[model samples]
Target: MSVVETLLVFAVIPLAIVLLFAVLTLLPGRAKKARYKPGQPWQYQPVWWEPHPLHGPAAGNHDDGPKAIGSSVYQEPQAIGSGHGSASHGATSHGSTSHGATAHGATSHGATAVGASAAQPAPVSAGPLGGARGTW
Candidate 1:
C-alpha cells in the first residue's frame, strides 16, 4: 500500500479512537443527584430554584368542590434535597370531607375527598419520612 494510504489507515484510525475515548471520559456524568422519577407521582423537592412555587396556579378543574383545587385545605411541605422526611407529618382524614374513602391525604393544602366525579386514583402522599402513605 502507498505510504500515505497506510499512514491514513493506521495513524488516523488510532487518533480518532483516542480522541473518542478522551471525549467520552471527560464528559460530565449524570449529576450525583437528579430530580426526576418517571411513572410515579410528581416528586417534589424544596430545591430553591430561580423561580419558586414550582408549579403554576392550580387550574379551574375542581373535581369535588369549588374549593378543592387551590384551597388551603391541604398543602404538603416539599421534601426536596434536604434528605429529610418523617412519618409524623400525619395525614388528613377524608371522614372530615365525605363519608367515602380516598387514597391519599395532606396538610393545609391537599385533596380530602374523592367525590363521585373523581373516582380515579387519589393523590398519593409521600410521608415526611420518605414513603408512600395510605392506599395511594
Candidate 2:
C-alpha cells in the first residue's frame, strides 16, 4: 500500500476514533448541576431520618420532638466493682479491704498485695481530649 494509505489505516483513523470518544465522554459533564459556593446561602432543604423511631427516648411521648443527631447526653459513671469478693483497688485476698487497708478499715503503708486486685486499672473519663480531629 502507499505511505498515505498505510498511515491512515494504522494511526490517523485510530487517533480520530480516540478523540471522538473523549469528546463524547466530556460532553455530558458540561451540563453541570447547581453547586454550593462560599458565602452563598444554601438552596437545598435538609432531611433527617431515624430508623427506630418507636424505641427511641422521644417515642412520641415527650412534649419536645426527638433529640437531634450527635447531641450529647451526660450519664453518671457507675462504680466498676460493687459485689463482695470482687477485685477493687488494692483489696486483699478475702476481698473486704481496699488500698492496703486492713479488714478493720485501718490503712497500712508498704503492704504488698497479690493477684488481680493489686493492679489498678486506669480511670476512664468521658468527652474528648485534645488530640487529632477528623471529619467525614
Best by TM-score: 2
- What is the C-alpha lDDT profile of model 2 across 48-80, one tens digit per residue? 233444444334332233222223221112233
Please write out the lDDT profile of model 1 over residues 1-25, one tens digit for every residue. 9999999999999999999998898
| Candidate 2, residue 89: lDDT | 26
- Candidate 2 regions exceeding 4 Å error are 31-136
Off by over 4 Å in 1: 29-136
TM-score of every candidate: 0.22, 0.25
Question: lDDT of each model, Cα atoms only?
Answer: 0.38, 0.40
lDDT of 1: 0.38
